[model samples]
Target: MVEVADTAVRAGLSGPRHPADPARRREARAGYGLMSPALLLMVAVLALPLAALIVLSFWTQSGFTLDRTFTLANYWRLIAPSDREVEWMGLTFRLAYPVPAILIIKSLVMSLTATVAVILLAYPMAYFLAFRVHRNKAAWIILLTVPFWTSYLLRVFSWKVVLGYNGAINSGLMSLGIIDAPLEFLLYNPAAVTITLAHSWVSFIVLPIYVSLEKIDRSMLEAASDLGDSKWKRFRRITLPLSMPGTISAALLVFIPTVGDYVTPELVGGPGGTMIGSLVQQLFTKQNNAPLGAAVSLVMMLIIGAMVLIFLTLIGYWRMRARRAA
Candidate 1:
């Protein structure tokens, strides 16, 4: 028995198992079989459309005609510098196409603003649910989600009615004699768009954050308190760091989709509040420039991907420093 045990250990430590092993091959085949359906769905839903978009971006459109011949004109038009220049903050930029560039910047700024607002507003609610609520917690979660149960369009329209020049807010103010006239600046602006986006996405952000806060080990918190740590210090050192995963996830969930949202912006965002998604819609539908629209769509997607990568990198660096300090 001793000899047999020693022989088995020696064989196990000899080297890693070869990939050509029959058992390993069988497991790989089974795993692939299990994943085949999802893989097929991804290919049909995501890959094919992406390939078509890429192919379309290389082609040019003329009056009711799509030139199937490949050319770089569409891409060149996006990047080709114009004679025009704009100066901001003591720096001059020779813009390629000012319209698209401006719209992209506007979309990013609005999206980031909305994302930050969502996080700030959501954290307190999530904390309350996680820590303060002991009874009927499920009911509270249901109540939080109730607003989202209604149609998204209805919600936006409701905000419109509230914020419109002669809407609820203005009417209430007039009735109370707080102001003689309605506030025209309440609706149909970038602020309106940002507000709508933040409110629309806040409920979804709460669940993840709540789950994160709930999962924190109680013993560590208690230990901190016993060791003379204040409530804020405990939260700052332990709760905040631990809950970052959910907070970051919630931010991404809000940021990515809102950046590409055209409907909310279109309804609330007047001409001055237009975003890159609105431009893509116009190019595809109104302007009949599918190639250029496809190019813009691809560019927007690339920018979003890059931004998400940078955000993740920054978060990872922060986590590394925190871990080192600990």
Candidate 2:
């Protein structure tokens, strides 16, 4: 009789028509219904435009006439080998169309340089904010963000003024008898673009790193100290790993958007520093090749996506190795 009662109870609990199932189903339905609007908005805002871009990439445009018929000529032109060869870092690439290839390489180098600079510069400030500052921390954060409140254009222009031949640096140096002529190399080059981008994005990168560092548990550090670990060792073994999520977030935040940034490159890049974004703009407007422009944009997006995926994969592998060692 006891066995029979147990079997019956088990069946009731696992049955298809369980008593609480209806309420659970209703709750799930309500949750999905609540999320439907946001999902729709994302689809409308992001997905639709991306789909259009992809479709346009496959079409061909010529002389104010757009052909909806699918063709791969534009992409082929980008990918096919040409007679000219360029060597870099022990590798040679035969670029069919050198403009896109050169611009893409230039943009990547500039973006990476800027990202590294931002991380290096922001980390110390963020570390100070997280661990050093005790009182009026909010005021410090506000001060850090004050430069960002101005128009981004204004900020870039400010850098141009500081870096330009007749700008502040040259004038100050000239006044102080540090130099006779204005420095021509200070502006209108890759370095100038890199500097402008780094300064422009540093404040935005700091908060994420600061948040990550701030979220670290102090007890862990205390315990490490009690265990005879030096400050450097404790940070390497504890704080750094814990803060990586924010650092990685900060890196991605700067790297991805800056790769496509046309404004900084336009203002400071000049002819030598022209990025792929400027090329895309020219293709779409002056060159009147919308299809080719779309193809280049898609390729840039793909390259960014691939790089991000690889970065995440490496981070995951490192985390796994760390866990295993622990």
Candidate 3:
């Protein structure tokens, strides 16, 4: 046994010096060398901005000048009530302090709603593209993506026109005698904002799910059928589980942007649809509260980070359970 162990150690040490081993090592080094540039680019472009945001969160800026002093005042103000009094619209409004928890909760609700809506719509579309549609898929995908080629702002504005009282939808409905007058509850609401956002983000969700579903082997379905499984059974037991990673990915993609979005809520939401993003913008632009705005921005980032971490943890736990069961 000692001789065998000694021989194994010798073999391991000398393995890389062999003709084939040198070639394999060279290939491995080349692959890593090629990836190094991309890794550096990510660190510069993505990581740096996040780090700067974190630093800015702790910083206090007075007017155009930035103070490099680090203090917990920004974070403290976020949680503690402010004694400052202010007037708005002829009424005295107290700056009773902003609750970070409330903002975080509202952002989560909005993001989660939009994500769920996108997933619901994307799942059927992805399933159809993967299993039902074979011919003209490229053309169909192009058609789906054509909306993106146009200005995002224009697309959002178009929804406003459609939902407006004097807009095409109301006009058509009124002409058809579907209603006595234009519906007042259609636009300038949370529903409109959510719908517009979900519609705009549908492509993001569909593309990832379609890619995942496409990678699934056709033989797996046939094999399940051969074992007397119905379509629903096969989808529930096999397809849904396999496609979960894509769903989770799609949720992240939709949720992140929606949470930070100021445009959709501003354009469509009017008053009732005001999100934390709008609140942050108000602090910076209207109120000129840089320190407060920075605090809010930092809190928003932390909330988003927590959400992402929770989602990733859940996905990891589910994956581990599935692996163990398998």
Each candidate: what lDDT?
A: 0.89, 0.90, 0.81
Q: Can you rank all candidates by lDDT, best first?
A: 2, 1, 3
Q: Give per-model CA RMSD.
A: 7.3, 8.3, 8.3
Best by lDDT: 2
Tell me the deviation in Å of residue 311 in model 3. 1.8
lDDT of 1 by residue, 269-307 (tens): 888778899999999999999999999989999999999
Which candidate achieves the best TM-score against the true structure?
1
How many residue pairs clash in all the candidates, one count each? 0, 0, 0
TM-scores for every predicted model: 0.90, 0.89, 0.80
- Report the error of model 1 at residue 113, Å: 0.3
What is the alpha-carbon lDDT of model 2 when measured against the actual structure? 0.90
lDDT at 303, model 2: 97
Q: Please report how far candidate 2 places residue 104 from its true position, in Å.
A: 1.2
**Candidate 3 on 1-326: residue-level lDDT in tens?**
22344687996776566657767778768867998999899999988976776777787777777788998777887676556655432544344664444555666687789889999999999999999998999987887788899888998999999999898789999999999899988899878888999999997679889988998899998998899999999999889987877777778888988998999889989887778888788877887666667778878887788868877777678789978998
1 against 3, candidate with superior lDDT: 1
